[model samples]
Target: MTEPKNLEVCGSVMDGIAEKGSALESPSKKQPTEYTVYPVRWVVLFIFVLYSASNSLQWIQYSIIQDAVVKYYGVSSIVVYWTSMVYMITYIPLIFPASWLLDKAGLRVTTIIGAFGTCAGSWLKVFSVPQDMFWLGFTGQTVVAIAQVFILNVPPRLAAVWFGADQVSSACSVGVFGNQLGVAVGFFLPPMLVRAQGTIEEIGADFQLMFYIVAAFTSVLFVLILLFFKAAPPTPPSAAADLGSNLDSNFLQSIKKLLTNRNYVLLLISYGLNVGVFYAISTLLNQLVLTYYPGANEDAGRIGLVIVVAGMTGSVVCGLILDKTHRFKETTLAVYAASVVGMIIFTFTLDCGIIAVVYLSSILLGFFMTGYLPVGFEFASEVTYPEPEGTTSGILNAVVQIFGIVLTLTYEWMLSNISDRWSNLTLCAILALGTVITACIRSDLRRQAAQNKG
Candidate 1:
């Protein structure tokens, strides 16, 4: 064959080999079937939805129990912030290691370990936890973060493989929707639970009740993962290495390879800025409401509920467009644009009008913010040759978190030291960072396409 034809033939053969290998390594015999009627896939998705809910429920408690944790622990709001910040910081470094471990350990063990750790940490919160409880919570959050990586990162790739390109975005969207719904429920449920409790023991019991419920639900997911979820069919010992051939690029090698690729680096920068901008706002919604209404913690929580609800709604819309159009680049751009404008409006106007702005801005931000995650994952999966799905995800997610921490801390500090008059400048600076990175990424992708065509 000619060079172009030869390359095409080689590519075809590689595709065939990958597909067969994927089938053999898949744990589920039923996989390699099809998304349309795959019983196993649905079961997996359902179980993961519950698991996601359990994971997300903790965020609600973070907002709701902020006061209680502050009083009980004799700490400041920043300390409670560290309670979360620690988890976020720990998760970044662990991403690659966790991904590597997932490759070695398989999804089952990693997920189970995460679930159990989360359950233990959550249940410990029911009573008077020791000073060491911070460590316990930290450990649990680490495990939970690991679990979330698998839960968030793995299924869509599997779905893409099983369902073909046509359905990947939709499948990813649905799974993500499940996660956001969990967030919505978490935001809405806690205040009602707190209100229902009559006394100190009753309040303690209520938290315990929430803890056990989450644990039980996650345990069920653990069972499902053990019983049905498979990376691929069984491979012989000799072929096992080949099973991860696409992922064969080790963590360090993958980082080197990705960094060398201009598009990948641009993507990293863009995703990191996106995370920094969105998380800075999401983490501070409680404070924002209190800032405005004064003693409106409950309202802040409710607004959180509204924000998540709008985000969930926006996710559905964005997912449909992205999946149907396959316009990954444009979709991200649109979301970022909406976010920048929203931040500007909210920062400048700071009135009852700003409440509506906050509501709309938060919802759009959540929608666009989370909307990028699956797409970004899909892009990484497409660009990277093979099995390092977890590793690539780890790298991307870690960068986002690292930048996110800096942005979050700086924003919090700015709010503390400066006036609300400064919100616009801080937000605009972050948004400008995002827009520039995204623009560079878009330019690089265009260059790559041109080079390939030439």
Candidate 2:
């Protein structure tokens, strides 16, 4: 058995991090080292994808059927809405602890926390649903949301550890794909399962059944992860990944270094803007649709499903392009620009009195908006190289959660007080700013540069 060793590194990438135009110095020359891409990496990635999806499904589960949840539970709309809001609320504070745990305990332990939380929460919801205990269900939702703080930070670190440089971005995209797919399920499945027009007893039974199914699936996954998930591969997959293992794992130190990096700071703001708006739209989609076209809660869920599906396609396409071109800045900017354009078109067309057009517009809005997620993750990893991916990625997730809470509340408030047109138009303006910020990012492909060294 041989130990994994980091070969010679390009010290220049670390030196030029905070300074623009000051990092062109070639990697200190060193002999190339052979790295292997293990077949088991795919198995690990598949398991991670499943894990991510399981947790993300809960995020929009209540939001997609907000009206029904309120009716069945005899609760206020806000209480029903809190089922989804809790994810952002809990993630904001817990991501730091989750990241520290990832740094110290590794992926297997993190997966356990996520899986167990999800399983326990699902069972708790099942227990609460029969009696119409809204508070208990909310507690269950809170527990699962805490699990997400751990789940969301896994992709970049997992990709860096298990994939070669050529495939890392695509691998990251696939990891995020499960989460988007799970959201897609949440959007559609509830509508099919729990009929809003049914009697209260019937709907409550439906809710109980839904929770039981989720609990069964999560319990099985918890067992699978316990049996199979490994912390790391036997050897490194690429030079950058090899060196990344040696990067500083100190939580505060990683945060300090990432904050000082100019490009990463810009990305943090831009990513927050992009994701925060997505959260707001997702949270209020049912209401937004109902405002214009009454009795269209199901349509809202389907439209959200369409958006997530399109975004899943966009993520893979963009990931392949990044792998081929190594053009993180261009891809991110293009996606951000498309998201702006999509939002503008969606804002005006949503009230066109045609559901078909609304669905079409949702595809466009979702394709770029959702697609931008993994791109932002990969880009952050690139710009903040040598910073432990777990720590750096944790900060990114935390900022987005903060923004998600603020933007979700703000947009929902505007919808209640003002008009839909103004609220959406406001989002368009914020997205445009994010696009410009994406354009201004100094293309410091530090991680990629490290891989291409002599």
Indicate which candidate wins on lDDT: 2
* Candidate 2 displacement at residue 70 in angstroms: 1.2
Give candidate 1 regions above 4 Å deviation: 1-37, 127-152, 195-203, 233-251, 353-357, 442-454
Instruction: State each model's CA lDDT, in order.
Output: 0.56, 0.82
Taking all chains together, each candidate's TM-score versus the true structure is 0.79, 0.93
For model 1, the local distance difference test gives 0.56
Tell how far residue 65 is off in model 2, in angstroms: 1.0
**Could you tell me which 10 consecutive residues in candidate 2 have the lowest summed lDDT?**
14-23
Candidate 2 lDDT over 335-430, as tens digits, reads 999999999999999999999999999999999999999999888888988787777788998999889989989998999999999999999999
Q: Whole-model lDDT for model 2 versus the true structure?
A: 0.82
Predicted structure 2, TM vs. truth: 0.93
Root-mean-square deviation per candidate: 6.9, 5.1
